[model samples]
Target: MNKVLISADHVITGPADRVITRGAVLVEGGSITAVGTAAELDTSVEPEVPRLACPGATLLPGLIDCHVHLAFDAGPDPLRAVAEADPGELATAMADRAEQMLAAGVTTVRDLGDRDALTVTLRDAIAAGTATGPRVLAATAPLTSHGGHCGFLGGEVTTDDEIRARIARNAEQGADLIKVMASGGALTPGGPRMWQPQFTRDQLRLIVDEAARYGLGVAAHAHGTDTIEHCVTAGVRTLEHCSWRTAEGIVYDPPTARRIVENDIAVCRCVSGDWRLFLEQMGPERAEAMAGVIRDMRKEGVRFIAGTDAGVPGARFGDYVGMLEFFSSLDFSHAEILDMATVHAAHALGLTDTGTIAPGMRADLIVVDGNPLESLDSLRAIRHVLTAGRPIGM
Candidate 1:
């Protein structure tokens, strides 16, 4: 059995909230065997085992992205590009995107959208050791209304029968979860308005029920206030882009926020890309309006998971650390933000063994040069990354 020992100045164990100084982790095969201070276990390991020591670094669980679109190329015209590419071509691009994400210490990612169910192919390849990338939990194709948000992906379902059939097809394809576009989006021109609800309450409930029958959780993409409320009532597991937009302006519905908390539904704000560019595109007034709504949601005790929405236009893969500024801007502590990217995100994705550093857990971790708890910027200083006890060649 191959064994490796890694010791760091500080080890964040269990969750981002816990830390052990001068800590060491022992890995045998692909699982963690022991985690404790170097002085406690260094002498007990086999003398022939290899050891890596970083005196001024911190080790923590590998990051998890709850929302992403691996099929989109993050190009200026991702939709056009996706529409033009065949499945084989799209899979190649997705593999490159996956490698980029792994380089940035994101060892696990939940792909919320894809075309042709290609993400499932990539997910299987990674699991079979034929690819070098994060462990993927992919939603084959997102359900959308006719000409609604992302309807071009070919998952448009109108009637209850269509919805059930689509859900069954995705489950047959080995989807890890189900994604439903419950509201209109800004990405599709001439589609429903961004503040418009795409699906009726009954349709949304049908999606939730059908997905539950397949033992798959539903992730609802909701921006409008009505859509958000519908998703909550439908009992979806997670809400993506819950911006609470309206025709007049952003609204902070306290009752809906409380309902989300009561249901324990995870929310992925999907904030990413260059902040400066985002501000310029959104304009100061619109940006501030959206930010205010998000701030209010945080105040209402909504649970947040960090997701970059990578592969979207301007939201490049491998830039996950840069997106941390958004949470910091909301006055989230470093530990809290890290939790959103790690433990909280893992739980949201239903990953049991990949998010925390503990005995018998998968050895997915990253070592940075400085203390991330003190400075979030340290996360960018990635000295090493291990996925399933194997080093990522950066």
Candidate 2:
């Protein structure tokens, strides 16, 4: 196995309990063999091995975006774009988006929805090293109620049997995870209200039960309070959009929050950085209230995983800087911001490996030019990206 040494002024090891400091990492055969002080490794190894040195720079695990829709173009009318474009066009566009994401220091991503299951094909291509892109966990299609949000992508079911059939088909098609739209969405024109529960409790339960039977994790898109509770009760592995709403104003029940904490169900906030569009759609008062609720949820002991709902209107891939800034606006410390995008985000997708820089893990890493600890915005200053120990062509 050929070895490479990378030395940096600061290494933010994403592993738990690791302190940030100056260090060097030894990579051999696409796995990190050692990480320690530069003096420590240099004194022990041969003097002639080439070393890529980056003084005053910070090295950390590559970032992960857990919620994305590669089929949508993140434009004014993303669904309409998907509806108009052919499969080949969408695939090529998705490949471009994936490369852009890698250049932004995102090494792994989870695509929650796609049309015609093209995400699976792209994922396979990237994994085979035939394409330059991030490691992908693709959801074949999101399950939804008839005429519900994103139902156009297929996988709508009216009965438990139909739900099982859809799950089987997704598994047969090589999906990495299962996604379900438990509530209506704002993007789907004339769809059910965003706060309305789209599926019956029984139907949701059956989906979860069957998905578990196949060793597959599920991410439920739930915005309403009732739907969030229903998804939790059904043992959903991950909850997306978790933006709760009700008829009598927004509800924030402490018991329900505690249940999510106890059940260890990861929650993705799916925050958006399009301040103008959000203000226009929600008005100033409602938008402020929604933002406040998200902050409160974080305070109430609910685990918040970072995801930008990329490919939604105005939410572009490789633009996670907006999400980091959003978290900063919420008063999250720099450490918290990085954790949400790195280690915590990986756990939300049921991915145990490839989140951190460590021995015996996949060599998916990013090299930045500045200290992200000093300024989260430095993430955009990507210098190099490596997947499986091979440099990604920019």
Each model's lDDT? 0.89, 0.82
lDDT of 1 by residue, 1-394 (tens): 7688999999998567799999999988888999999888789887788999989999999999888999998888888989999878888989999998998899999999888889999999998899999999989889998988888888998999999999999999999999999999877878898779889999999899999999999999999998899999999999999999899878879999999989899999997758668878888898988888778888888889989988888889999987888888878889888998998888888888978899999999999999999998998999888888878873
Judging by lDDT against the true structure, name the best candidate: 1
lDDT of 1: 0.89
Off by over 4 Å in 2: 15-17, 276-281
Best by TM-score: 1
**Clashes within 3 Å, all models in order:** 0, 0
lDDT of 2 by residue, 1-394 (tens): 7777888878778842364477888777667778788889887767887687878687788888888888888898987898889888889999999988888888888899988889999999998988888899988889988888998888777777889999998888888888999998888888898889998888889888888878898899998999999999999988998878886667776677789989989888887667557657888788777788878878877777778788988898878888778778778778877888888887777777677777777777777878777788778877777776777662
Q: Residue 212, candidate 2: how far off, in angstroms?
A: 1.1
Q: What TM-score does candidate 2 get on C-alpha atoms?
A: 0.96
**Per-residue lDDT for 374 in model 2?**
76
